[model samples]
Target: MLQQNLYNWRLVILATAFSGASALIYELITSRILLLFFGSALTSLTIVLIIFLGGLSLGAALMTIFKKRISSTGLVFSILQLTIAFYGILILSQFINLPKLFDALAKLISSPLLLQFTGGAIFILIPTVLLGAIFPLAIAMIIDGPNDQISSRIGWLYTLDVLGSVTGAALAGFFIMPNYGHTATIVLAGSLNILAALIVFPAGKKLRLAWLIFILLFTIVAGLAIRNQKMYVIPKNLATIKDPYRQSKNIDIIGQKDILWEKASPWGVITVTEEETELGLDKILNIDNWGQCSVLSHQSESLIADGALGGKPEADVLNIGLGCGFTLASVLNNNPHQVTVAEINPVIYEAAQFFKEYTNNAIDDPKVNIIIKDGAEFLRTSQEKYDVIVIDIEHPMIAHSSPLYTIEYFRYAKEHLKTDGRVALWGYMSSDPRYLKSLVNTFKAVFDNVVFAEFEEPNYVYLFLASDGELDVKTIDTKGNAEKLLESLASIEDVAPNTLDNQILQKYFK
Candidate 1:
């Protein structure tokens, strides 16, 4: 009897470790899915973690209350594992409709935070709760051993569970999701849940052979069904969910559009979508559903190079955010002696080839050096100075992108600039004038001369030219946008600058 009990306890320990790994894997994968809807903001991650941990806490409380009712800890543990697998798969199958669901919820709830919380609960609450119950039950069963070294046993179990979680987070983020995609990663997690259940099934004569065989057959069929379901593709139109002004426009994003190219990466979901415009076919590059650049935006992007170079054709330039290679092409048009392009996402660099015509094949140019690193990080670490530094990144409201717009980032750019160097930043015109004014003030806080350029057609997009030296807007008017830029700089004052310590841009958007 002693030997059999020891064997069962060993299996329970193994099952506990597997359960820990599977739970973390589910959390990461679900958070990534939510990222496509909510964007790459910390808010998106916060909503997911809150929902997952909340459910786990509730599940643990329930398990403690009902411990006496469970006849066998091992049997109940096995059942919970199976339940999590089923629930996880069920949730994944429904992910394709998330955009429609989010839109409907947005109509009723104006708050993006509340909508994200509601969506996260819909997708992950059940599975996380089931995951939470497993740990407490494992402790109860392991403590049933001889009381002499019960503390040691519990410590070992806790250590294994934590190690398993670390492994799961590493694999899901760096290996599995990037290589096999989200569907396969979730399926793999579900398979581990099944293995955990099979391991802890009542051992020997207590094991029901019929039940074991039935579960094995059922899981195989269910796995196949999950594999065959349609994969979710985030619609191009749904990319504006984060912007309250855009979402208020009531853009219908119900149906799926044909995707030209798509890949899941550690950064986010990189998608290339083609749309027919009056001029021709325009391909758009989007990261995490936020449109980065399109062929049509090349004219606007050219202004970055125009303002930076200020007619110094041979000036060395640093261009950030590859985005369809439009700004790089514009930099090349200036005939810069050397151009270093810093782009955070490797996948975006790969997608640059799609816009070869519009970009003048900028990625393959002999004068260009492409470094796959964050623009802000590159500036801080590199000692190389440039005559012109162009910041062509995404909106400041994005959590990850917010860092690039802070006073600290401008200071770094200032450090790496030559005596007569100039910086050109692509600015987002927020619906709220306060945030827009804050951004301009932030740039002015770092440089002596700051010029603002607004486009005639796209009223929301603009450019900021900053330098310690005298920068004439007339000197860099390769395009006509800068013709009126000097007149607009007067109205921006009395606003606090957006800084790394206080994220004004992200808060305003939220």
Candidate 2:
């Protein structure tokens, strides 16, 4: 009794769920993987997405041509294709030197824009073709006759997969991954794929049992191994403590010196550290780019030293893209003052306590209140005012973070500011001049005062300080919580700014 055609309905349901999970995982890796190398530039994001989508669209078209010739059950082929595509995507993102590939492709393709688009396009063809083939192939496999009504099945499965993608995006963006790190996230996604394969094509009792055990062992081992993958050892002068949450191998303690106290979850890394010479456990470690290099003095220093500009009332503090707890750490460090942190991901609130820096007393501070919504949307909703806000996110490099930087967002930031309140804006140059000018013009529309300032020698941060009224750094009072913070900054007196001795942002962030 082979019962080849008598598979249970439960099998199909499991297939569908597995499909949803795989789809989610694939999308996450697709959208975010190249960030470390590409730095999430608009060019990088557009290339990846356009290529993937275009390939998918192309694949869907081709499936019609191939479906008639394929054998029974497109499910097997679809799952296999996805598994292959997943591995390919990971290799391109992590193992390969994609940055070099991108450069070569740029020269080969001629047009920079076209080159980027093509780069993503080339990567997209595999998954897209397979994905495109899934629908028609599945329908052909499931139904008994050419005229059979399988619309309900198709509709339900399609809807479920899309819903799952949204869920994945929300979960990864807001919660699960921010505290877990990317490798663990990937492994979780992969296990779902393996599960889908077993359920859809479970050969026999003995084989099925073996697969289950294998998967269990594989997941446990993979999770542990990749959990600490992004970490490495960095030389420092503080007392390094093992943080299970961060899973970073590079985190070091330079005696009483500041160290990388990073918390990496799906939410990205929330890192805080100080230098040795500027000890009292206070001097902030100078980090060039939070999204890229977060090295201590060896590479360079932080552009804007923490609390460098000084804190003041009517200061409109803006947190553009809130990550784990580090940005919140900066906000709470100067707390008891009214603070507004704009976080697009809801999961950040849940994992706030996972990182000791933000958990113990940081989020609990009376002055802190967070809006768990899009930073751009929150900007539109604000009628109240602020003193200082931190822009903790970057643009669409791997995925798409474009909405945060559009003219519309800048205009809203302008309106929410007190006439004297200034806005802190970060802009990177993996950019077109038009985009930069658009940003410049957008802020100019709202305020009469704007300064395009960048740090020299150590860090390369281009900070935009804008005001509608006067530029007065002298009138602000550093009393109460700010005073204590100031005292901490002052204690690292030996750590001077703009030297081999210290970094500006590094000396102040504590």
Candidate 3:
């Protein structure tokens, strides 16, 4: 009997390790899925972490309360593991419908924060609670024998659990997510939970057949569901979730158009979309449904290059962010001596091939040199100076974009500019006034004189031109364009500059 008890203890420890691994794997995948519904705000990420950890804490508390009544520890542990597997599979299968659910909840609750909290509680908390109960119950079972050192055994089991979690995090991030994608990763984690349940099921002939049949059926169903499910399909009803600020209008456009090409990278999801606009077939590039640029906006691109170059002909220009090559094409039209483009994502360069016709074959031009590297890092390390530096990146509100807009990055760009050279930064006027003020202040912190230019009709782009010396409106060349641009710049309200230590734009804008 003593030997049998020792054998059971070993099995329980192994099962707990697997359970712990599955719990962490589920957390990683679920967080990615939730980001689709709730925009990637710091507050949203914080709320998600809190919800997951809070569920675990609640589960442990409940287990402690009922420790005395849990007569069959193995049976209780097996049931909890099975339940976690069941709920994980069920939630993943229904994930595509989350946007519609959020929309319905939005109608009932006006506050976006409250709606996100409610959605998290319904989708993530329940299964995580079950997962939390598994550890304590496993401990109870292992400590049943008098010879068992409760504290030491608990420590040993916990060490195994943590080791399993570390392995799970690495696997989920590096191997499973990159190769099999999100749905498949969840399925893999769910399978681990089912395996744990089989290992910890009560050792008897009474319910062994029943448990085996249940696990088999679940595995088959889950396998088929994962195999059949389409990867990254935006729900049809997602647009019904209203955004008064129009911050998610780009997401709606992505859902409405036909996706020509899509790639999932560690940075974010890169999608090339073709949509019929008033200008005709427009090829648009997006990073995680945030519109980067389009090939249809030649006029806006021309205006941006003209304002930045300050009418300098045959000048060397540095263009950061190769978004569909619209800006590069515009620069080439002016017949620049050299145009060096720094694009961080190679996928964007590959996608640019499809838009070669729209960009006037700028990618193949001998004068245009495209380098795949981070914009800020390239600026810091480059030895050459530029006649004009154009910073046309994604909106600062997006994740990882704040770094490019910080004071440190702007100062680096300033260091690379020639004495008489100018820098042009592109931003949208559609953002909040406070956010816009913060951006303007950040630019002013680097350059002494800064002016703004508004692009032609149908495009809401605001071009910020900055220089060490006073900006000459005559450089704009277009009649009355300079005065009009400076007028827009003069109207901006003052605000604190964005720095590496204090990212006011990300904190206030989000």
Using TM-score as the measure, the top candidate is 1
Superposition TM-score, candidate 3 onto the true structure: 0.83
lDDT of 1 by residue, 1-510 (tens): 111243356667788888888888998888888877775467768888998899989999999888877777777888888878777665664576799888888899887778878877877888888888998888877776677667877888888888888888888888988765777778778777888888877766546774477477656756775565333333444323332222222222323434566666667667676666554665678776667778765666787677678667799899988888888888888889999999888777766666766666788899999999988789889999999999888787565578889999999999989997999987666666567667778888999998766653233576778899988765444456554443454465556789988878766552
Candidate 2 stretches with Cα past 4 Å from truth are: 1-10, 40-45, 57-82, 85-97, 103-110, 121-124, 145-175, 202-261, 265-267, 271-378, 386-414, 417-437, 451-454, 459-465, 470-510
Which candidate model has the greater lDDT, 2 or 3? 3
For candidate 2, the 10 contiguous residues with the lowest summed lDDT are: 498-507
How do the predictions measure up, each by TM-score? 0.86, 0.61, 0.83
CA lDDT of every candidate = 0.75, 0.50, 0.75
lDDT of 2 by residue, 1-510 (tens): 112243444355546555565555655665565445455444455566666666667766776676665444534543554454355435433523556677778767776557656666565457655655555544454554234345665666676657756776676556555556666566666656565566666466875675666567666656555754544332242224334335533556545543444445343554455444321223232211243322222111122214423456324455655444554555444442566676665444433333444334445556667677777667777787655445555542323245555445556666676546666665454223333344555556566865554332244444555677554322221122323433443444243222112212211221
Cα lDDT of model 3 by residue, 1-510, tens digit = 111253377778888889888988988877777766565545557777899899999999999888777667777777888888777777765787888888888889998788899987888899888988888787776775555576777888999899888888889988787655676778778888888988978767877987988788777878877765434433344333232122223332335586666656555567777778777877678776666777666566667787776568888999998878888887887878999999887767766665666667788799989999988789879988988898888766555555788889888888888887888777655445667667778888888987765565355666777889767644443445656544654687667899878778865564
In model 1, the worst 10-residue window by lDDT is 243-252
